[model samples]
Target: MKYLIVHDAAPGQFIHIYKHLRSEGHEVVVASRRGTTHRLPVKQLVYELPEELKGSRSGYTAKVIGLGLSLYEELKPLAFDGWAPDVILSHASRGASYFLRDLFPRARIVSLFEWYYGAPNPDTGMDEGAFRQQAANAAATNMPISRDFDCMDAGYTPTLFQRDAFPKSWHRNLEVIHDGIDTDFYTPANKRAIEVNGKRFRKGDEIVTYAARGMEHTRGFVEFMAAISEVQKRRPDLQVLIAAADRLCYDPGEKGKGLKSFVDETIDYDRERTHFLGLVPEAKFVSVLQVSSLHVYLTKPFVLSWSLLNAMSVGIPVLGSASAPVQEVISNGDNGLLVSMDDGQALADAMDHLLADQVEAGRLGRAGRETVIERYGLAQCLQRQLDLMRG
Candidate 1:
């Protein structure tokens, strides 16, 4: 079957699936933003908005509209080609592939729906402010995509919590299938150590790890810094290994300040005990997890991060926030410990508790790994994706 995948940026999970499909002798075509190396059959397309509409300060809706228009113009040529797809998988919520229906009317179209924004949700409360108001209004951008929903055969989301974010009418069309983790590759080591600044961490060291794509309010970056300070007061022997950029990827309203600003003002700890490794390689990242006595992951009621599952798969105990996406994965005191996102003292206590008892930590970590193997294994997830596409 000829399968066409459309996305603004090449989705990582889909790229893996594309390779799997090719191995099974299926024709797969990926159209996305240029300069991404997918190692597959891809048509690179770059869409640039007019100079007048190009600015970071532009409204969210305006930007989406501009992107849709630009992408439509760039991809319109594909319709003229003799190549026709039997199925189309689009990662769009801003009408990026709404025009594909006109080109391939007979093809079964599916949307890989990641998120649908609404007001007063987990990310933002009922705080009266311009930013909050804008976030609330941002839900209107889904209208264009919603109008085109009937044209789509189905919608796929990684988690049920994420799938529920869309309109009630769309829930029936939505399927909950996670982009699973590779348990065999992310397995824990019998003995693993990593060197930071000439000091090597042994298997018995009290190493705590915190990681994210970026440090910002959404991920509870400031709260983590405060919690680490508290953890230091109790366990001076504890060493923190953080993996993230110093700047904010998600706008937290502030312009110049980031985690660095919070560290300078709040965190007071010996330089030797704290290490900020800015985005280490994947192999090195796995080494950090191997040496970790405990791992902390926090986020608002948003998307479930792959890092959390990967850390769990590494067989290290995790202390995650008791939020929607996290609660779905972690059961308190069973597989992992769940703490409040706002409670720094609680976070510190959880870290200390896990560090103090290696036996209990090991038990939880083993259970966490088992959970990933059972529920989020790559083979099971890939099979589900194949089933969805075949339908």
Candidate 2:
């Protein structure tokens, strides 16, 4: 089958599937804006957007709606180039193929959606920003994506939490499939020592791991820091290994300040014991997890992080936020432990308990690894995605 991917410059959501498709003799073409399209193994048709279409007072969804039209315009010649695609896959948040329905009328278009958000964000389900007062803005914010979705042949969400976030009317139309974890690559390994920024952590080190977690409110970074610091007070030998960009991706902060500095100013943690590896490579990250006594993941009611699954795949005990999304993956005291997103004391207690009780931690770690292998295996995810593309 011929496949065409519409995406932004960053590595796409279906990268592995596309590479596998190419390996299996399927022709794939990616029409993307200029960032990281070079990573794809398939042919690519890159386009540049006009300056004005690049950004606006509106959010990324709005910006992409404008950019999608430009992409459609750029690909107009493909209608006569004899490079017709059997299916089109795109990230709904990114600029996708819009206004090309007439050109590729026979092509099946599928949009991959993550979680949905509105004025009164689910994280702060407070009295402020009532849906009624913000209804118009919210609808307009969602209008472009909704309109594009209406024209799709199928909609896909990686989790049931995400699918259910869509209107109840669209639930039946969307299917849940995980992006999957490479168990073979992420599995536990025995190591004598791992080094990061000149600090070497050995097998006996009581390392607490956090990964790909920006210092933001949504990820509950503040809570994690506080909880871990409390644990540190009790366990003086405990060391923290964090791998993430110091920037805030989901929350607005003061200009010229990374959340690391903000977090330092607000939260009191042992700086000497904490090693900020600021987004380490995959090898280093896995090594960190392999030596970890416990891994901590905290998030609001938002899209779940792949790092959480990666840590689990490494057979490490995970203490995650008890939000709906995290709860879906972690069964407290079974596969993994969880506490309320904002309950700093609860998070600290869980961390301390898991770190102290190695036997119980090992059991949870093994169960967590079993869960990932059974449910989110890489082979199974690829097969399901291949089926989606075929349809």
Candidate 3:
């Protein structure tokens, strides 16, 4: 089968899916707004749009209007290129869906439901009033796309969650497939342990952790920092490494700036204990996970990040918040630990327990890796996508 996979950018998860489809002997083409310069295995088709539509904008209204027109203009020529698609899989909702449908009407349209408007906690990068209005508009845009599509697919979220967020009637078509991990790529390696500054870590050095970008209040960065501080009070040996690409947001000097409101000022973080190594390469990132004893993944009631899954794949036992997708994946005291989203004390306690119990932590990490291999491996996900297309 020939598949056209569309996403805003080449999300690592979607790229894995694209590769999976290709390995199964299916012709896959990936469409993105940004030009493809990276060495991804699949065929890439870049959708060029106007300069105004590309930059960081204030409201969703302008973006929606710009996206709709830009997509129409960009995809108009694909209809006559003799590049007929058997299925059109997309994320970011209607823009890609509508464009692909116009190009190939008979193709099965399977959209990955990463989010819906009324979900418990959404990542709206704006004020409350503005966010609500934008969310309503986005919901309005998505409704028609869902109605028109033949199938809707979700990676981690359950059917009930999707139904609750969207119109209840559309639940019948929703497919809940576990987004798989490449066990081989993420497996534990025997590389020399390195510290945050690339120095060799000593045999018994303590390394507490957090990994994510845009350290906003909603993303649980502040809470994680507080938790680390609390944990460090009792276990003074522990050092926290906050690994991410954008370090400017977390800097105290950049407060009150645009999007910097997400940063919290109350927490008095220790500079020496808290090391922010702004975005290392992928190989080094994975190495950090392998070397670290405990990994803390915190989020509000939002979508599960691919990073958490990758952590699991790499055999790092995670202490995550009991939110929607985290709760869905992690069973407390089983594969990994789950703590309350808001309670810094609880998070700190969980961290302390995991750090103290080396045997238990190792067991959890091994079990977590096994779970990924058995249930959420890349092969299983690929077969599921094939089944959806065949159906």
TM-scores, each model vs. reference: 0.89, 0.91, 0.81
Q: What are the per-model C-alpha RMSD values against the true structure?
A: 2.9, 2.8, 4.7
RMSD of 2: 2.8
Residue pair clashes in candidate 3: none
- Looking at candidate 3, the ten consecutive residues that score lowest on lDDT are 251-260
Worst 10 residues of 2 by lDDT: 250-259
lDDT of each: 0.80, 0.79, 0.67
Q: Evaluate residue 246 in candidate 2 and report its C-alpha lDDT on the 0 to 100 scale.
A: 82
Better of 1 and 2 by TM-score: 2
Error of 3 at 377 (Å): 2.0
Q: Please tell me which predicted candidate would have the highest lDDT against the true structure.
A: 1
Q: Candidate 1 — which residues are off by over 4 angstroms?
A: 34-42, 56-59, 121-132, 144-148, 197-199, 251-257
> What tens digits encode model 2's per-residue C-alpha lDDT throughout 1-391?
8878776753367767777877889888887776656665566777656677554455655565666767777777876787678888877764456565667889898878886656665456644545454555456556656765787888788899888888889888887888888899899877647887788898768989887646677788777888888999999999999887787776532333346777798878999999888877677777888888899998888888889999999999999998999989999999999899788888888899998999999999999999999999999987887787677
Q: How many clashing residue pairs appear in each of the predictions shown?
A: 0, 1, 0
Model 1 agreement with the true structure over 1-391: per-residue lDDT tens digits: 8888777666555766777877988777776654543445555556544566667677656766676677677656766766678988888566567567777888898778877766554454445676566565566667556745777887789999998888887888888999888788888987887888788997778889999878788888888888888888899799999998787755534444457666767677656788989888878988888888899999998888888999999999999999999999999999999999998889889888999988999999999999999999999998898889888
Query: In model 3, where do residues sit more than 4 Å from their true spots?
Result: 24-26, 35-43, 48-62, 119-164, 202-204, 247-265
